[model samples]
Target: MEKRKEILNELEELSPILFKIKAEGTDKNIVVPNGYFDSVENQFLDRRMQVENEIDIDIPTDYFDNIESAVFAKIKEREIEEESKTPKRKIINISRGRERVRLSFLPLLTKIAIAATLFFFFIKGTDYFKSNQSIEEIDYLASISKTEALNYIAANTHEFETEQLVGIEFTEEIKNVEEITSEELNSYLYENINELNEEDFSEIF
Candidate 1:
């Protein structure tokens, strides 16, 4: 394009001694060719030098590509450096006091449980012994004579083959017999034959 070439030509004309000066200097101190264009070139170079001298740094290539990204990277680097200088936070176990107290009481609690269990069993055994002591023991046929006692036991013997009534023993203490008449025996057997039970046969003789 003609417009692009014109701009390039103008840029070339604007700078003739770009690498000639590395230090601060005015355009009047530099040489220029004799022409109307030389005056404009001198003014342009003066302005260029003034701007360059005011700058504190040489800008990086990437700064022109993405200015916001470059600034954000600089801010993040500063923050990382500040964090590295700060001390780390320490974590403390909150339950340590309760744990120590629990450990101290554990043995005492176990011993208490064991003692309570033993005391409950001992109380139950004593109650069982007291109850058994109150029960009356049955005496061996103390209300009947030797002949009558033998006959009564024989008659009341169980009829089941697995069950049998063995012998009886009289104690050292003597007992008085409550005698029944012959008429009473006859009336009892005649009237109660159908209603007779094994318990009744035990007293029939």
Candidate 2:
């Protein structure tokens, strides 16, 4: 208790406003000015009365009760006026025979165009197939050994036309005239004689 009293005395010496406790049995030295509390109490009371008066304000009795119905009635009246002022559409019947006749040739022309396109593609496709087949045949023949190819051609000479062999040259080893029989030679010459020109005849002779 003595320690606390000493600390308080030190604080009071340093700052009187910070340590305001009075000594035991001694009245507080700080005093309020005359009428300060009276003026503050009167201001609080005036503000309280003003707030109470604001809270106790009044409004018309039926205003809220009819607000929703009045708003809805006004909206419905506006909708009705808009509907009355809007223009209505009327459908008129008319003949379409002339229009139909004018466009009648379109379908026929379209069909003809489609057919022509198909025909053109068909012709091109056929030619492509024929050319591809011929190329495959030539490749197959070229892949065979020359000896086997010559033997095969010699064996099947009657089956091939003269025009088919026009550009080909026979090697001397494969073209020995003595190896061909007289009957085969005669038959080949007789069959291709009509197609032979003077140059071919001169070479043969």
Candidate 3:
């Protein structure tokens, strides 16, 4: 008890303000607004509800529901487009009659056949009609029209090749014609002009 009293006296002499505060005693004097704690939860809820109510956005009807199907449909369409672009070529025979045709690259023989068909369809239509041939009356321009029974190919050329048809252009014919030099033509003519007379010319014509 004597040691305690000596310690207190030393503290008081060292700091007189601290000594007076200790002597007087003290209580917590912090002031808070009334109902501040009680209203905290209510204020937070009100702010959250206001934020929720204020958020207004528009979306199309059924948009979310149909999104998956719409995406699939677009994917399928793109797949079909990719698949349709193929390198394989399609060749259509005029005899078979296809919807789509790219005939520019047909073989010479195939082109000749197609040319013959076109010739029959276009040229002979007039001649056969002139000869009183009807659709029912004539057959495929008739294999039996000539006396000898259907000898398919004749040696006669100007009469045979579709290009040799009078004054008409065979636009589809792919035959190559070699250029005749003037010297060659002159030499041929000098040699054969006598032999190529009126009858020969007439026959050729």
Q: Weakest 10 consecutive residues, lDDT, candidate 3?
A: 146-155
Candidate 3 Cα misplacement greater than 4 A, ranges: 1-30, 56-205
lDDT of each: 0.37, 0.43, 0.41
What is candidate 1's lDDT per residue for 1-205, written digit by digit as tens?
5797676566557764642342234576667678868589889999999998898466655645663343334334534553466344322221332231111222222222222323333445334333433222112223323343333333333431111111121111111101222343345446646655554444332
Q: Over the full model, what C-alpha lDDT does candidate 1 score relative to the true structure?
A: 0.37
Clashing pairs in 2: none
Task: Please provide, for model 3 over 1-205, each residue's C-alpha lDDT reduced to its tens digit, 9 standing for 90 to 100.
Answer: 5797787798799999988886777544657789899999999999999987786445456766764454334434533553466233333332222322123222222333333534444545434334542333113223233211111212222234332221122222222111222343335435656645564444222
TM-score (all chains, Cα) for each model: 0.16, 0.19, 0.19
Rate residue 195 of model 3 by lDDT.
45
The residue-level lDDT of candidate 2 at 157 comes to: 47
**lDDT of model 2 at position 62:** 74
Q: Candidate 1 regions off by >4 Å? A: 1-37, 64-90, 93-205
